[model samples]
Target: MKPTLKPLAEQVIVITGASSGIGLATACAAAEAGARVLLIAREDKDLRPIVAEIVASGGTADAFAADVGDAARLRAAAAHAVQRFGRIDTWINGAGVAIYAALRETPAEEHEQLFRTNYFGTVHGCLAAIPHLERGGALITIGSIAGDMPSPLMGAYAASKHAIKAYVEALRMELGEAGLPISVTLVKPSGIDTPIAQHAANHEPGEAQIPPPVYDPKLVAQAILHCATHVKREITVGGAGRAQALFAAHFPALFEVLAPKAAASFIDPARPQPRPDNLFASVRTGRIRSGEHHARRTSFYTTAAEYPGTTAVIGVGLAAGLGALIASRHRTRH
Candidate 1:
């Protein structure tokens, strides 16, 4: 039988990369929804303020600093959350890193680091959280559209996401074969307005920006919160992302021609080259939002992803209405 997930109010949610971006957004949303939140990140200084803010706002939250890339440390964080809250209802593996440069320019060690954090980190989180999760618990990982489609500058990050997608699929199948009552959801967001670009290690000239049609991080947060209680196989966040995935699925050759054009425009040629990077170490303090470069508007992709039946119904209704109008016009002409 399928698992029946508990609502956020009754959940004890442990989130990695909770100090910033989508992870931070989800942490706050879960806390606001009455979940006991355990926020983990590499820096305590970053996690402390966010936790304090949530608690000050009458939410239950605590910070545990750890690098998700470190298996033992991440496992310890999971154990601490279980110890503090009794049990963990959901584990969100949201920690990841990105690199913006040509594949040739990127060093072997940087690629290794990307996989270490993005892939191995997720593996660790899953292993640590599984034993403590009762029936109906969830494991949500934040993947990227890059996992589905190729892009130019973020080759390593994309590769890591692809690995994550495969790993999650395998884990999901294993859990089902074992008849364990748990849900695994992979959330693939398009370009999201997060501080990730600021934190990424860049080899390119100008700053690295998320590809166009960026969706708000809150949209991603909403999806994460939904998956905490509901079972969704996977959901892509932005319209552009969904479009690329579909296009790539049906027309790979055409996408290959178009994708690089899209990628090339991501960086401004006029922008100063040789900018600062954050790959080897933490250069900036963690924050909830990034710069104002990304779009402030939400995407219809969120609605379509979260509520497919409703979207289909709406599509059908519009088609019927258009058909009726055409019929009326024909009658008038007659």
Candidate 2:
């Protein structure tokens, strides 16, 4: 059985890690589109203001404070969303943390905590959302390009994302075999211009920075919202990220030769001191975009991927036109 999702205006959406970054962006966008949104994060103090702002803008929204790592807390959050909004049409698992260090350099406790939030958090979100969405709905989890490619300094973080990808894929298969009406999607984004780097635990020489070719967080939010209504199996937000993954997959030796230098570039030597991070706890900032890096607003590759049929027709037309132009030039030369 395939899930039939409702339009954004008529749906109730629950977003974990909603206090900031991609989660906050998605919640605000959903509410603006008229979905009843329940925002979940670890800090009520951080969530309340965003809720108030959304409410002031005449969007239906509420705040729920809970750690995604805690299963009971996630269950409670799900119950609260149902109690407040009646039914959940979509659930987005976007809560995650990062660590910037070699795997050997990272503490065992930190590695465990990172997995608890990044991996188990998605698990908890899926378990909590399935009951509400069995009738029909979307289950979206925010993954990263690192989930597919190797990340050097962020080994633990990459490992967590890889685990998430595996788990989400297995869960999708199990749910499909069970004949449940649910659309499960994993959204893999490249280095997005969010506060993730600022919130990441840094064990390196300087502050952690999202590698180059950073994309806007709003693009990720747009993808998430689109999946709320569309039944996409997986969506990679940035084309460059997709290309990197493909290159790594096809040319493992070359990628391995260049990966360490590429990874070391993530550390900014200009910033000698490490910044405050949210590895163990929540940072109280609600700003969406990280102002440190300039992010591209549009991604033609993403647009083409999202609407492949249209792009395919356009590509054919362009190819034919170019061929005619080249033939004309050859005739003139002759």
Candidate 3:
């Protein structure tokens, strides 16, 4: 079921990777909902406009420059939020990188980079905010559907998500027992039609291959706000994302059958290095497109991100599973 817009007069939220895509869209939505928004990205290069946009819309927002992978930076951002907003009621980490490589061929550096951005980045946000995070606040992580099932070429990204799931689940359990309002949430988006695919890292020369999926980014963004309004413990956003998550849980045989085809779409060529382009990158989508039934966020216990096989994730998720269709940095005529 779809959820109606809720008021956010007294809420404050900090979102990482707010310069573009899901992070950017979500920041806009949060501000419109009446919350005081804190935006953080790896650089100030793209933040000024975002900050100005929010402020111009009769909402409150501020941008801070910081890399999600940097613990020190996140700490400072978190500290800044408290001092500026008086308190932080919500935290969302949307910064991520999709690297192409096989389990054996995947380099230690790439693995570390993916983990830093996808996994530990979330961790840093949580850790930095925990002390001042407030008992009644919420912690939200933007995870992929790949976390549950094994994707062929995108192993590291999936692995990082698995790690995130493990951490958030445990955090939820602990917080529940502690009777704290500090609820933990994981948002698993399907093929968000976002520019994440465009920005994804390719193999050096020839690495591996995979298939692509599709979904809407704004839908994912709306679903996120859905969670924030109600603050559900965990939510899988959108239709395809939910299906992929279900595949990991209820139907392994089907997952195995479909996994390789999706993987081969991106990484099976076994090239000496990675391919720079995302074969499944969709046609440019810009301007306001209206559609019925804006996707809803539910308290549904959807599946966790889990693509163990390296190849499966690359194709099915990186290529096939698209979530948001918006790209702040795209060259499309707006």
Q: Whole-model Cα lDDT per candidate?
A: 0.86, 0.93, 0.69
Candidate 1: residue 232 Cα off by (Å): 0.7
Candidate 2 ranges beyond 4 A from true positions: 272-275, 324-334
Question: Scored by Cα lDDT, where does model 1 land?
Answer: 0.86
Q: TM-score of every model?
A: 0.93, 0.96, 0.75
- Give the range where candidate 3 is weakest over 10 consecutive residues by summed lDDT: 281-290
lDDT, candidate 3, 194-271, per-residue tens: 555445566634433223344556666776766666657566655565667677689888888887676666643443
Model 3 Cα shift for residue 68 (angstroms): 1.8
lDDT for model 2 comes to 0.93
Residue range 251-278, candidate 1, lDDT tens digits: 9999888888788766766665333555
Maximum-TM-score candidate: 2
Ranking by lDDT: 2, 1, 3
Best by lDDT: 2
Clashing pairs in 1: 205-273
